[model samples]
Target: MKLTTSKGARALVLVALVATVGACGLPRSGPNKREIFAGSVLKQGDAYVVTVNSRVTRATAVMPAFGFGSSFRNAGVVGSDTINAGDLLALTVFENVKDDPLLGNTGQRVSLLDQVQVDGQGYIFVPYAGKVKAAGQTPDGLRQILTKKLDSQTPDPQITVQRLAGDGQTVSVSGAVTGQGVYPIERPTRTLSTMLAKSGGIAIEPAVAIVRVTRGGQTGKVWLQDLYENPGLDIALRGGDQIVVERDQRAFTALGATGAQSLVPFESQTLSAIEAIAQVGGLATSLADPTGVFVFRNEPAEIANSVLGRKDLRGDQRMVYVLDLTQPTGMFEARDFLIRDGDTVYVTEAPFVQWTKTIGAITGTAGAADSLASVGSSGG
Candidate 1:
């Protein structure tokens, strides 16, 4: 019985060995060596060029009126010597006015009125007409006031008042518009858009793209885009008001195991980790080791010294973040983690996978050789 049992055991062992050898000889179902090789080469790195949508919001284009003919009409205080301040006036009192020698034949050029400056004050400086305040008064208004003042001294004293330089008017233009400098307030009805066009419009790619008006120390942000949407928003600009155009500076980068890795432009001003991942075409399913996904960033040396020595990092030396996505929640954190410019992302390959593939290849080759030998023997 022992001999029979041992023979049976030997036979069983032989059968098991034969089954193992036959199984090895059969073609494997998964991707072939050539296919895997091709896949490995093709999927090795991320694509260099990637398409990103532009952030600028498109609006309806409107044809603006062009040429000097469309320019604003010159009105309100046009002449250079129209009016000014601090000029002496002459108030002349003609006794027997019609018979006065100064009123000779023609009364047009007669010295009928005279006023003069006194005590450094803006008043008609007359011989006996002390200081009369003419600061806030216009030419006509000053004329009347001087007439009253001289009349008090001498009844019906003809008076004329002219300004030296009209209160030094000026307008300030600033913000995103070009040529941000003070412009002379030539007209009181200058439109905001006209001034902007004169100053070469707003800077390109402004952060805010909205012009802010600061007048009398009050601030307000106005959308330049709105001007096209609603024409009324392009109101007339006033003196001492500033127009500021804010610049936009929000961006993110895509790297690592994605199909296309590039700097993706975002206008939302804030880039979420999830959005960034989608921007780069997501991770490679077959090759990417989801567990080994990592983002490298700079941190303070003092804080990182506990986990990694200061010598590990170079210059302005700092910390390095090592993230392992093996845990289920790690992916969630990665989705939440904000990516900045110049950030490096790495996706590692699965461990021991290459070894298994190598062994499988060796076994396949041995099986093919054995099968060929068996066929040769049969043919012989």
Candidate 2:
């Protein structure tokens, strides 16, 4: 009777646990493959599900273009010697007069005029020249004008004009650079690379740094490393240009059965799907289904149309792409496929994992029942 009662009690506990586990469902990182597929657009779901292949990889491999436009690329380097309004000129006049000099005393042969500011009208005031045009003229050009004007007053007047500091042709540099401030475009800092060097180089890693230049209403961007590798991408720096150096903010979320379920940043300018998985520590080996890998993103309408081979989709559409790593070309496809910003990389648990959980739960409950039955019998 005792043996039969113990067996019955264990069977009852096992049945109760099976029902409870079935009703409550096993804890999972995310939905299974079937649940994910059922949510596809073909099944009245919000997202469009597509299997990744060579065609799909090619269609979706496009990354954000980051190079200067024609206007920026074609822009010529500005001459540092050219003078403009808002520039401060330092002028020194050498008088050859013997007794009484018009601009200087007998002993004072050289008259130092410092901080001679150019006005908005592009003119500078000299002792005798009286509002001489300085803008659009180099230092030597301005010196000739000053000498010519003072020639009549004094026997021989030799004047020299030097640009002390320029406030007119300057570029403001900020963000992720060692030095951030407004810098004048001088001979050493006339181009993009030179300007970045003047600002103490980029503070972030060269592999992930982005340089953005905004001129007037238009903005152009380039990878910091690419700017050096490709000569064509190193554009000239114009006056009033705003240069910003920053770390690449693009990242993706690693969820489901990935080794690490967290946000992972792009290690390089362009990131592949396989590279992204590697960055997040790869898939959870014990629980992950090698065949059930997915990438979820809101793809643009054009890419979506191309990927699905359907023109009906308009605007940004939710998309879920599947990758069966068990296939021959699956690893190659993943290597070629690009992962965009805000994408979710997920790996579903193997089907057998849930069954294993069920078995474990049942055995645990049966063991507890056996222990209770043994205790009750001993007490009686």
Segments of candidate 2 deviating more than 4 angstroms = 1-4
Candidate 2, residues 256-319, lDDT tens digits: the string is: 8887999899999889888998998888888999899999999999999999888988899999
RMSD of each: 17.3, 2.0
Q: Which ten residues in a row have the lowest lDDT in candidate 2?
A: 371-380
Residue range 1-380, candidate 1, lDDT tens digits: 55555455545554555567546643322222233233331356211111111110011011122111111122223333333343344444443344433333444334544334422343444445556665546567766765665565444656545543323334566766778776643343256666677677787654236666665655655556655566555655544567666654434555545555666665433444455666677666644556555444443343233233234543333222334455656555555555555455544444445556556665665565555545544554
Instruction: Check candidate 2 and list the clashing pairs.
Output: none
Candidate 2 local distance difference test against the native = 0.89
Assess the local accuracy of residue 98 in candidate 1 as a C-alpha lDDT between 0 and 100: 46
Candidate 1 CA-lDDT value:
0.47
